[model samples]
Target: MSQRSYRTAIVGTGAIATAHARAVRAATDRADLVAAVDIDVDRARAFAETWGVPRSFASLSELLLEEKVDVVHICTPPQQHAGLAIECLAAGVTAVVEKPPTLSLAELDELVAAESRSTAHMATIFQHRFGSGAVRLRRMAAEGELGRPLLATCDTQWYRDEAYFAVPWRGKWENEGGGPTMGHGIHQFDLLLSVLGPWEEVTAVAARRARPTETEDVSMALVTFESGVVASVVNSVVSPRETSVLRFDYENATVELEHLYGYTDKNWTVTPAPGHDGLVDRWAADTVSVPSGHDAQLAAVYDALDAGEAPPVTLAETRRTMEFVAALYASAFTGERVRCGQIGADSPFAKRMDGTGTPWGKVTAQ
Candidate 1:
């Protein structure tokens, strides 16, 4: 049987929307960018023209009404993700949403319910997980070549100035969900969760040290996984020297990835333990290099759609990652260690990230 080609549309003409369009264009064989949607008609038209999309609409409803879209990339703000995704799923169109999929676990639950009622599925964009280095690390770990993971560290310490947060939605808890933890660090930590599996508990601290936002500018957490691997997670937007780094210490070797934003195979390093030096040859011999970015993940999504299967970064996987975000906030604000499954339907953290309210007293005037 021949593989089916997907007609994809992007809803939102922001900067990230262009990345989605480029990724769609790159996978010419399996997907085509047919339309673009945005509240600003001019912006939509401009984006459509630049990306070679045939049509542009001012709203998702209008685009859905006219275009034969098989997949819709929800690239709007975090606030609109749940509603837009639910609408697409109701129409039997798969949704590919960006990170921090929804503002809260409750909202994500709604998306999950919508998916259950429709033939379509929803996937969040955690592009790092699709990178070849990540793929290789996971394969080695599974094969017992890396041995048992004992310790890990994930740091997303990127710098964002006051002007960046001056945008209405940038740093607000009610709008963009949370600060660096939700918007930036999510990618690296989601990759961490992908490799480590289920988490058992989390103890965290969040503070607004510099930025003039409603959310924390810096946050740190100690996460314990069910496999007994412990990890230190740091999310900060105030650092001058920005870096996205993840290191895993296993029984036989130490693996590290040092890069900002995205990574290729070259960014990864595997150092075998003194007694296990022979494993170094095995690592060097396994040659596969694919960069981490939208293109890699979009290709996987289109392939899954062609096969009539759930796409990469499935809703269930995203939910766990989002739940971890919730646990981080819950532990940070309440000054209590939070366990997995602790933030259920009744938990305030499930309803809103700042459910218990900001731990820091008030945002002092700049």
Candidate 2:
């Protein structure tokens, strides 16, 4: 639908930046990778050359000043997402930011406020939500075909060794926000939130268990959704057996998705309850195969842009996911139930993921 291909630019030349470039290449009919930017000019130049992009710059300011880039992908660290997104919003350019979108609820609120003042938009990369399986499940839930959702479970169990955190910005609260709950688990859980509408409350507990980091290495939560659904959530980076799993049990069927990083239609399975075996045929009617990845989400983003509207995973929607993150952290730290919209601007949790301070004291070898 986009008559003119969007001249897109990527601002970070890190590991995840390649996925963004590949996504741009995947949507060649809708977008063009016109420029690359990084703090390391040589790295940016090499990335642009490798990706066949036209230009490279040492910083976003230089790229913004020189190129008419329509969309900028912020693939930098968690602390940098808000600033870069705000700059893009102010410059009248659309920004697609990698998660966790910001370091705190306050920063996300800032980006949301900035978007209200700009014509351009801010979108977060929750790619798993765009896959065919998730879409079908959400449609069924919406149409009341899945029956009353009763129970659910979401888990993001992945391994991250000490060497992985030695990169200077991997585990610190000031850098990556929280541990797996903020960085790694947010992907699958955001997909869960996408299907389950709004959450009512969270009661969580986190521990420093293994990692010698400033934040918790593992977290567990009990979440209650507004739809009368109760779900248990777990996030960890210390598990030897790495797996990302989600299971939804409705009155008529049980739907499950099992994958490590990404999922295809093949990774999803549906089991009908007694006397509801007919629903299997209905679920089988959807045969589309959109895998969970940046390409699929970016394709959808371009479609929204083409339709003269803000992109998918926009600020309004991201706020809900982020507030969930905040609530989980608040409940984990304070030993009390945290509800939706409870952590306002006055709350310390709004300022940082660890709030005023963490129970772990300092980053000592534990």
Per-residue lDDT tens digits for candidate 2, residues 231-328, read 99999999999999999999999999999999998898999999999888998898788999999999888888889899999888898998999999
Candidate 2: minimum summed lDDT over ten consecutive residues — where? 357-366
> lDDT tens digits, residues 1-366, model 1?
357788999998899997898898888778888899999999999998888888999999998898888999999988999999999999999999997899999999999899999999999999999999899899989999988999999999999999998888888888888988999999999999999999999999999999888899999999999999999999999999999999999999999999999999899998999799877787778777789999999988877877889998899999999999999999999999999999989999999998778856443432
Q: Candidate 2: where is the Cα deviation over 4 Å?
A: 362-366
Count of steric clashes across candidates, in order: 0, 0
What are the TM-scores, per candidate, against the unseen true structure?
A: 0.98, 0.98
Model 1 residue 274 lDDT? 79
Clash pairs (backbone) in predicted model 2:
none
